[model samples]
Target: MSLEKQLNLLKQIDNCFLALNGKKLPSPLGVLDRYLWLHEKAPYSILAQGGEEDPYFIYANNYALSCFKYSLDEILSLPAKLSAAEENRPKRKLLFDKVAREGIVYNYNGDRVDKYQNTFRINDTIVWQLEENDGEVWGQGALFWSKEKERPRLVYRI
Candidate 1:
């Protein structure tokens, strides 16, 4: 991803969070520093989906990529619904609906499946609608994390 696009994504996440939570996501002030922190240093799992009838992942930071056991390229091509198992999709849809209506939702807990089909649960997630400066709803974004020990066994690519 281009530096500009990453920076814009950070702005979107920060603005949306601040609008709802009354505080900004903490990061360094400089552009490059903030981008690096988010992608390489931040402890949270961060990701966003593109706006589509069936959305595809548009972004996933290092932590998120690791948690989902997907490479950046692999994830960007994935449908957001696949993040959860088939039986759990209905619940995922409802959560998205709530985010659409409420603009943001905090402390969301849900089960998710990784590329290896191992199931894990996410707790205290923050889900929000991604909106542009002109008020267009672009998609949705999420940020959450769990300790490695708390997550399911991961199957690493050989």
Candidate 2:
């Protein structure tokens, strides 16, 4: 994606979070600097999915890519539902429904599985609609922290 597009979407995520929680997301690099820090150096995992029936990941920061054990291209091609274990998809759907109605959901905790089938629990996640200023919903964005503190490590590159 173009840098402009990336920045716009990141801004939406930041704006939606601020609107819901009355505070910007924690970022030592500063809020407007999210486009750079979030993608390259932020500690938190960030991702966004877009589409209607079966949304696919449209964006996944390096941290998120590492957490899911997938390269950017791989993650962007998978359906968002696949992020969770098969059994957890129903619960994930319910949470998506809630976000559709509420615009944003905070403190979401869930079990997620990576491409390698390793399971991990994500706590205190923030999920929000990637809505445009005019009210068009493009997709959903999320922020989470992985247990690992190191830089993104890709298992495979394609």
Candidate 3:
């Protein structure tokens, strides 16, 4: 499809979740709204959020869902570590720690596991800290698959 057509479609989809005035809704609902928008615009994108103790997925687009062969509910319920291969778990945790301390970490390459427990290489995954009004840190991540011969690119931005 043409870019214009795709964008129009995305806009229509976005309208269903976001208010007409463009204000976002509450926590998980707002997350879901954006998820639907991104899913329509870029299905391959993965959206994740982490806590002090666990990295849980708060949202993922349909393309991301299909890539992992998971339904939305299944993916959201999973810990972020579940996406990392067993051997990569330690490194992933270390990277998460780095993001927590520094506010953001970029260009990190690693393998991520899908629902079927398949692993895919993520070339330039970014992890960032999400802060509340009080400045407490929460974890956020954007994951994307790299193209052949090119560096891995971030599929979505937080």
Off by over 4 Å in 1: 27-32, 148-158
Highest-scoring model, lDDT: 1
- By lDDT rank, best first, the candidates go 1, 2, 3
Q: For candidate 1, give the lDDT of residue 114.
A: 98
lDDT of 1 by residue, 1-158 (tens): 67678667776776766766676655544545665677766667888998788999988888898889998889988999999999999999999999989989988888999999999888778898888777688888898766533543322111
At residue 80, candidate 2 shows an lDDT of 94
lDDT of the candidates, in the order given: 0.80, 0.79, 0.58
The CA root-mean-square deviation of candidate 3, after full C-alpha superposition on the true structure, stands at 9.7
RMSD of 2: 6.6
Candidate 1: RMSD to truth: 7.0
Quality of model 1 by C-alpha lDDT: 0.80
TM-score of 1: 0.84
Query: How many clashes in each candidate?
Result: 0, 0, 2
Candidate 3 deviant stretches above 4 angstroms: 1-37, 146-158
lDDT tens string, model 2, 93-122? Answer: 998999999988887888999998899988
Q: What's each prediction's TM-score?
A: 0.84, 0.82, 0.65
Candidate 2 lDDT (Cα, whole model)? Answer: 0.79
Candidate 1 has its poorest 10 consecutive residues by lDDT at 149-158
